[model samples]
Target: MPQIPSAEALRHARAALATETETIAKAGGRAPVTDPVITPFVRALRAGGFTIQTSASGCDALGTCPACQNRYLYTALRAGLAHAVCPHCRDAADRKAAVAGAARASAGPCPPDRVGWRGAAIAAPPA
Candidate 1:
């Protein structure tokens, strides 16, 4: 049988949920308190000392980028993105991903003879 939470533990859990709900309300509800994508991103921003200000309708926000210290506006409708992210940082990340992808492509596919070996261990010889 599974152990049930004690009465006191249940009460504490309820209180915590209530507090979280209130916080979400104040933040304009752009993302829920438990949102998989936005919640952790917002938490990381706050931890990095960035302030996020949201509109009353919960569709827009303004925040500063900790990486570049540039202010950026976030709108869910603008680019089909659901979360607020600094454009500069986003661009940097995109460039980094592109470079990594290019590097991987340049490395080429594994030889058919190395089918049993892992990809990392089957690096193509330099041209």
Candidate 2:
């Protein structure tokens, strides 16, 4: 489980990021990452043995979570649903399936009908 950041920690990080962003805008360059507030905040948390890690990439980064609106939703390749969903939503769907019993193969194309006799055999006189 990931450790949730405290309000204070979030505030500090936001301030640091804003300060750095403003500085970069003034300098006409991308933001420099040497914000002083960041180091102190991280060090304070480290002293308490709390690790701060951000969600980097994967499906979470590619799409937004439908439930939380966070970029934590990932693309899931399930049988029926052809959409991206968060892990929680996927589990809920699984539970629903179990309760509903196995799905019948009724949606896909129907199998071909068995071949039938074209017509009654015609008797022919000796050639």
Candidate 3:
């Protein structure tokens, strides 16, 4: 049988999690919790399946990556974003985008007929 944490321990963990959440919110998604006194409690709650709800504007929080299902810290700038990816996954996405962009650029310009109205306007010969 597994040992269960006491009520006092759970309360302390909750408080620690709240404090860290506030710190991250105040820092605008730039600060990570490094307080020696609080980190362990927060980590414990997280490992025990506690979830912290972040603000809609933005926040830095520890979260599980939806894509990889691995726990990681993620920062979101807005509400619409899926803020679950780790740094490694984000870097990989950026690299992939860069490669695709390079491929498109090297594929040469689209034929004149294939160009949209905006493209045609830009490419039109001077009147």
* C-alpha lDDT score of every prediction, in listed order: 0.35, 0.34, 0.36
Model 1 weakest lDDT span, ten residues long: 92-101
Q: Which parts of model 3 are misplaced by more than 4 Å?
A: 1-3, 30-42, 45-127
116: Cα error in model 3, Å:
62
Q: lDDT per residue, candidate 1, 1-127, as tens digits?
A: 1112223443454555567878888988853436433344444443333333333342324556557787652311111112335534542111111111221221234232221101122234567
In model 1, the Cα lDDT at residue 98 comes to: 11
Q: List the residue pairs that clash in candidate 1.
A: none
lDDT score, candidate 1, position 17: 55
True lDDT of residue 81, candidate 2:
22
What is the TM-score of each predicted model, taking all chains together? 0.24, 0.30, 0.24
In model 2, the Cα lDDT at residue 19 comes to 77
lDDT computed for candidate 1: 0.35
